[model samples]
Target chain A: MNSSLITTKTQRHKEKHYEVSAPSVTQWWSWFKDHHEDTKSTKKNDMSSDGNNFRSALVIGYGNTLRGDDAAGVRVAEELARRHPALRCLSVHQLTPELAHDIAEVDRVFFVDADAMADHVYAESVEQTPARSVRSHSLSPTSLLSLARDLYGHAPRQAHVIGIPAREFDLSEDLSPAARTGVAEAVECVGAMLERS
Target chain B: MTKTITISPVTRIEGHAKITIALQPNGDVAETRFHVNEFRGFEKFTEGRLMWEMPGITSRICGICPASHLVTSAKAGDDILAVEVPETAEKLRRMLTLAQWLQSHALSFFHLSSPDFLLGFDSDPATRNVFGLIGHDKELALKGIRLRKFGQEVIEILGGRKIHTPWTVPGGVRDPLTAENRDRMLAWIPEARQTVGIALETIKKVHAKYKNEITEFGNFRSLFVGLVSKDGALEYYDGFLRIMDGNGNTIADKLDPKKFEEYFGEAVESWSWLKFPYFKQFGYPDGMYRVGPLARVNICDFIETPEAEEERKVFKKLSGNVGVVNNSFYYHYARCIEMLFAVEKIEQLLNDPAILGTTIRSQASINRTEGVGFCEAPRGVLFHRYKVNKDGVIQQANLIIATAQNNIAMNRTVHQIAAHFIDGKKGKITEGMLNRVEAGIRCYDPCLSCSTHALGQMPLHVELFDANGSLLDSVTRS
Candidate 1:
């Protein structure tokens, strides 16, 4: 939704396929650092800051694994678990209400999901949204954060969404080549974010 | 002049559905139809796949009740293999099934339907949700979330993942219950029990408050169908098919699930993708029966657990002389009772020493060309039938989904609520009135995704049209 923060592109494969170029790790880190500082300066009361240090972090990567590139989020979480065993990572089909408790216990949280309409992987800070009607079984990341604050009276000091660009969402377990590449980039970006935190 | 009120993409349920209410010249409801709009050809597409891959593949049919599909598919595979699953494996499978029931029912009650009861049905559509529940009673909301999480945790411990785990296999489960995981499950029992108990009390108050709505919301005399143990006790995992009439008479007992097609028939409607399943003896609409929590509690003679059995006694009294609770709104009440039973049953299963046994799976080649597996899913009775070749490649697959089994009844429920709430003469409808109609469908907690095997976005759009088919009034909610 934030066009300025997102960089979109179009690419052609065997068939003309629209693609989003992934932001380099350095560019992503720079954006995140600036956004982090902006949040601290603008909303001091909102962040339970421990002098810019987060004690614990949780990564919830959720999407339908059975769907094609929709599995990008879960694949990223699974890869993160395999690569960084010490990190607390959960790969679920969708975000449900119970995840609020998990989110409340952490100082920082990253919600990774596949962005079907996006051309490239993008990360943005998340803010708690007012709860509207729950139209479906699944909850959005902002809604989950709201639930965490409303039900548990505790929310992560920092929350962000790392969306992997995904196109194919048909009934298949394999990710698209573009999505696979996006997953790699997203994972590296999240890993760097974790290190910086 | 005739009028039609269409509610598209019915909200708060698992999948995409629409309800159309036809109003007669006198402003009376003429007919109501619940139309499931999406279709996933799981039955047809499953052909040519090896029998062993079914549990994993069919499990993907729904995120809400994947465990039910997983377990039922495995049972079908077991029949193809013609090998009796190990005793420990059966116990583990039972635990997983109960866990599925707990979580799925909790979601249906607390997250989906509770807003209608806890907050008045006429409350603001924006605030009438789980979020509203959190604002109104934070502790209750927390308990509901934790209760559902407890069920998912038990499932994760058994199947290795919360959703769509392929741990249950053809002969048995893929893993045994380790003591460590068993301990984790045991630690959750007390809180889970307390939450269910609290929910039960809350539903009782809701029942008392909405006495008039209860009788009008799918309150009809049709046959109730579910699986009952050999001794006529409540059963979920494996049992004989039991069909009880509205008068509480057992019309059919000890029916073999393998011969489900002979006794049960599926009728198709041009309007909806969901099939209407009926009792073959009664035929078509006359044979209309309800399944799911309302039907399950009605058909079962007794529950094995102590606390749940006590609640079942009070639940039965709601039917008065008829001896069956026909009011579908009581589906919420029955769901709470079942959750209590699931928690107690989970504890009982955990305490069983044989549950920890190591011999989980049995290996075997194809022994039969056809197999049928039936179980009581969280929604209702789920049947998976498969036909295979000598090499065990699937040739045909037919699934009798629980939601589809209640198609006729859901339509009837929509009609009943529409007639009671909406007035065609006024040419106007309130949001509360429309919500009551949708709430009737929610009683069944119909999983359109599992029934139709298709998942899509859900939003509510209501359109009112005159006999000439010109739009008169419309309301949209997304």
Candidate 2:
């Protein structure tokens, strides 16, 4: 691990309380803040009234809408974007190799996508370090980051996987009850992550 | 009355076909037609879709060479957008396209066309298959299939979706390649080279035994058209086109295929839905041209790699330099050479660090205009022209597919093969002769699916009438 990761390990031990100090990649997190601000119009808006300040957090949700419960992530992204004015939101469905290079350059990134059901549960997020799992997509987040580092030498500072356990991946355009619940919870969880960031 | 032979289920190909042969009661030549029996409506279904979605959507039309159509359509959209893409993007597309050629042509030549060459043309029909091929020579069968699969794997890895590539798009590609992926692709090269070496050995054996089949199966003269580098190198992925005569003399060079309207024309036959493309200067069957392996072999002055160069040397030595080869059957030789060339090319393209660079796609805005996309499909030259509105919706599209481009020539070559090789004795006019004629067509690897359709029957048909409009006799399949 790098010095920042080591420093965070020590800080967590000393505090003994669950307090994430945000991404220490200063140039990177500040980048998110600057761009998130730059993209907005010059106006002083009350953040507490706007569903609390989203601040410098970037929330991304991706999945296909017509793919049954597989659309959970996108639905969550859509809701989050509406709720938090400060949250930078993007909902990409069909990712391709063509997008790999650019996607891997973020200081901190969160991917919200649909996945095959886990233990047949509604949804689950991997809370710790990611294990090497083969992505259903050739241009999965890990592979894309590998590509960025290999081809472009610019891997993002942080990436977290928010996988919504999906019940169906059929060709239908409707969402199941379980999938709907997963999306709501995912939105809530992402709202929490944004507050921490 | 005329008699006919109909094979309603033509198997062992990507799709289905029904072939009918017509002959007179007394066994006189009448008319011959290759009929297409199945239809998949890709064009009608793809309408109203985001024009950028065409590449992936159109690819599903055929599983055999989906990448060809995918790349062609993607380029079409890109061209219409009037965006000047980055060089890296163009090169990456070409590299992917060449990979498609390597796999598709390998499938066409070694998998589909090999049984005829390996087994005797007169071999029992039931035994003329991959099983039979394995029984004849197990190692050759294994080697060929493995090589084909490797090509498929490479495409799948790079494009994300292999059979239906969703990665290509308007401004360039949607993503870029990394050093890790490039290294993975490069690892396959040396083995690919060895596989070609084995294939070349098989080529020599097959050619030696089937000398007459090689030389006279489809012996006829026609104009040949193919894509070659501006520098006259054999380039399948990107290049201006050159049309050469039977004697290998250049009729046209650096001809903007987009301006094909100026030099090329198509005629429709009453019997076949496929359009017969011909040179405007020559007209109809007279202006007919052959493409794919035969044309590629004829047009280019140089082969890029050492293995392909050596094979070219042997080809030129067997047939005298450029002008000596005229038989359609010799296309097998050209196919082998191209396969070798593709293997070498993959290594060269992937090794460039630029291939693994950050700019796989250009970060430019897109506009709308009329544009044409041209690339050499494994079977032949494929052209896609599109006109997009200011809002970037497709206004109109015209596609001249590789198989459609060879319709007139396929008919003429079939006629020539039947005339030259079939014996006068009716009993000796064997299945071998028909298969030989079909094999010649197979050499071009015509995708009748890409062409509009074929009417029916596969034999000479003739109707006799007196000068005074008196009907004498009607002849069908013999």
Candidate 3:
């Protein structure tokens, strides 16, 4: 019969503050990093052939995994981590300037997430990613790349983003028929990235 | 030489809030400020809109739990109209709120909070995510997914869409619940029960394993606020305002929901657009309190709903229930107990059968007036007070978000957690300490995006200070 469900107090601004919780969750429990760090190490291993290669890849996913297809970016990063142990991957609910480190030292980066364009007609395929499908902030790949450049140095030679068109991004498990299909298609895109490297 | 700790682009949490902790040479917390680098202006943007448009527009603030915002906003509109909502409308609204609470809470605990508790806070950060948790505890992951799905199912059946539905309007709901939707929810009852069972078992096991966390983690205490039955029973969906002290006595009660301004006041921060809402009587900063499940349970005597009350008794046995849950870390435990409340409330509402009746929503419109609406949102108390012109266009709006209520209390709670956990510890600050701190904040489940919208290039700075306010270290979020 027991039930459970799930604060900041008001305060004045003080001096310098660093996030105390960042170290714990970010250091040991980084799934994207675990999945991609192996590849980064492998890429480092490949660096034995080209020790000077500054190329690195970062993939960040945004959207809720609990609700069917909104978890596109997270799913791809998880899958990428599983298949390729050497690529650097960072998965997050949304993009932030704090993520610049993940984007740093990488030659090319690809970001994935569910696209929510206010004007985008919910058309069915990857074949139709018009500017209309481009949504507002919650982290955008282009904006993140710009931030990375501003913080870390130069932009990577190649930077791109892959988006999944969501039809019914409800709290439901059942994805709109179209979004369900994007999952496989997205996996293939990651696989192609893996092969390209 | 400098020492720096960074978790670039933090992962595995809802919203874009991130933590960056830099320590001093002595390894003390130099300065700590939880940062929400993302700018979302739902509050400001919604201005000049019609009162009825709020439920739809503001629901867009949070994609994860729009239903709660939708319902709360609608309730505010109802207050403005001063029309009594049909009983069917009220019951349906309760069901939707409970349903969303179940889904949102599951996402936070099982998917977001579980990694630290289950995989060990010190586990390799790379693999300590939901994906890793999935491989480590596949059954648990599946149950979490299923449980959230059930809640979403309830939302979808009633609202037509889970993310942002227009089913709820100003006077009442847009339409009545159909037999088909009602039956669909009924069919999922068995699975829902099973999922709750899994959650109860897993949390209990977690409690046994990390009893220290439940007790010693983030021991900050403050006034707890929530809605409660006049009899002091826990009531989330609809009830009068209640604020209880540490001694569990009501400091403020039966305050008209519309007259919240008389009891509460808002203050602004130069650093962030988020406002700090404090108790008017107690004054600012010091008057800070926390809401959400832990606070809700702390303030109420018993849950009026049958099964929820029984669950409360058992939850109380865990570290004395609300009595034992003085620390913020226990918020996670308290959250699971709330899941039980949501489940129980849903069952009670559904069986009424009249909940599925033909009459739903009131049909009334306010010409223009100043009105206040209060509802115990899943997070805690959400107060939406608006002033509109003759045409029902909003002239001014004030929202006392549940997170803002705990603003000052959260900062103090951080101090509490840090002081207790790190007392006399040798060597460098361990990752566990960091996790514990984040866990404490997680207890309140602050949704920064929904909290405020400050724009125009935020300065990225997080500093940890010692007791005397000496800067230990500073890190920019950007």
Candidate 4:
């Protein structure tokens, strides 16, 4: 099978383009400034106002893009970012400790990741897991929430793990058929959750 | 019966690895080995790709220090193109390199190693982590996180994203630094400075507290290697190579980084996937030397930044007239000092108006078939060498990563800590003792991801085997 046929949207974005100009520093600064202000205002609203209306949401989709099927989470995040320009989305290789700061500032957060053991797309509430002396390169969603509350004294009132079923994880930019379907389902599920919230 | 104890997938480091200790019939420590079991084959797979694509592809080798690979790989491309990047491009690359040093060092000191210092080494396994540090000192934890974030933001300001940025290309960077972005980075200087200050003071307290660990944790005579400025000041972006003996003598100096292969040799062992790098003159095993923060600090004659220079004075005193700090445990101290220097250097670079110049790249085709790029990664010196055809497709690639260079030292460290903490006579090892062994490895901050081109998740699993190779006991932590 041709690898390009199975390439995910995320991989297309990552394709080598030597002629493409780098993003403008000025434009990025403007966006960053606006995002900072939005975060502060949303945080204040979450603290003072009734928790029901004007809630801010953050979607963190993390996995290895080069690994087949592991790119599902990032593909879902790219789709969400395209569909809802107002929503804040982050696609990362892995979850790290610094992510807690983002998790603490929002009212709700969805941690999207590819799960090798899962059979289908699903979302489950994430509980704070007790700290353990594990590797620091990557963190589980539960441990990250625990870190948010412990360090910043704040965690999203609602947190969840959106697991996209994955099988192949070989060194390739393509996604498995199952993962491609899972990405779509996960994106729809997260969109519905964001709207209801 | 004799037995073997294995600590697989060592925790708090960048990649997957294990340590095995063989015991004599009397239960005395006989031999120890550090094994890197996983392999991603980046060197092998990168072949046949265009030289221009290398900067992006190689940067994915390790998530913890992608910028290091990105910058070094770009330097290799510069060599192939035979073009001197514009002045502004050089400065921009320097800024990005320092930002990476700041963030990577912060991650090493605060998130990974601090728990061992702030919380007791004997602390419960479930609570001896960054989360535990937060419960103990919220202010410190927040400062660490923010400091790291500040560095990441600088990278984002320069490149488009925080991780895996392809903004750096062959011959030069993709963009110039804008005034607004430069000012935003400058605003972070004060807090970054303060956090590094507090961290330095805290590490001193840790040094005073663990006097025994200071002496026994990988403390021995070995050569130290790193990059040094023309006048022998601390350097990260670019410089010639320098190798210093453990007794504070400069054995080799003013050697071109491009000729690194002439001085250093890589030796492979059957038990591990990671190669052992040694000084050529001294030979293998016996030629073993240390790299990274400890080596960088020992090698340079001085640091240009005022605050860091002052700390370097204090750091040198740790050697007490011998001149070179040999203890692997002091890697944390050296790392904090380097962070201070990185912040100071970043501020200086940002103040230069030349950083805003428009001429950032020099376009060229493959003028050279083989090119070697070398730079000081956060951990230590990193080299990226490539051989390409006239059409620019890579024929061969070699990556001498910092972690692989310290492989022999890490194994020695594991043995030293194991021997000191574990009394084989008792025939049992406590979790604390095991953690101390891991802590010794953490001092080097080995990124097996870079060393082995790592794959898969790393969870620590220690197993014990009797003389007949029968499993006696085991412990696993996820």
TM-scores vs. true structure, each candidate: 0.90, 0.65, 0.68, 0.89
Ordered from best to worst TM-score, the candidate numbers read: 1, 4, 3, 2
Poorly placed runs, candidate 2 (over 4 Å): A1-197, B1-3, B7-11, B24-28, B38-41, B162-165, B321-324, B364-366, B420-430, B450-478
Q: Give interface RMSD, per candidate.
A: 4.0, 15.6, 13.6, 4.0
TM-score, cand. 4: 0.89
For candidate 1, lDDT tens digit of each residue in B1-478? Answer: 6789888888877777888888887878888899988775778768899999999889877878889999999999999999999999999999999999999988888988888899999998888999998888888888999999999999888888645658999999987888998999999999998999899999999988998889899888899999999998999999899999999999899999879899889999899888889888999988899988888888998999999999999999999999888889999999999999999999999999999999999999999999988788999999999999999999999999999999989988898888888888777767788889989999999887633211223457889887667788899886
lDDT of 3 by residue, B211-238 (tens): 6766666565567777887787787767
Candidate 4: give the TM-score of chain A.
0.71
The Cα local distance difference test for each model comes to: 0.83, 0.62, 0.61, 0.81
| DockQ ranking, high to low | 1, 4, 3, 2
Best by lDDT: 1
**Steric clash pairs (candidate 4):** none
TM-score of chain A for the candidates in order shown? 0.74, 0.60, 0.58, 0.71
- Each candidate's clash count: 2, 19, 53, 0
Better of 1 and 3 by DockQ: 1
Worst 10 residues of 4 chain A by lDDT: A1-10
**Model 4: chain B TM-score relative to the native chain B:** 0.97
Better of 1 and 2 by lDDT: 1
Query: Which one is best on DockQ?
Result: 1
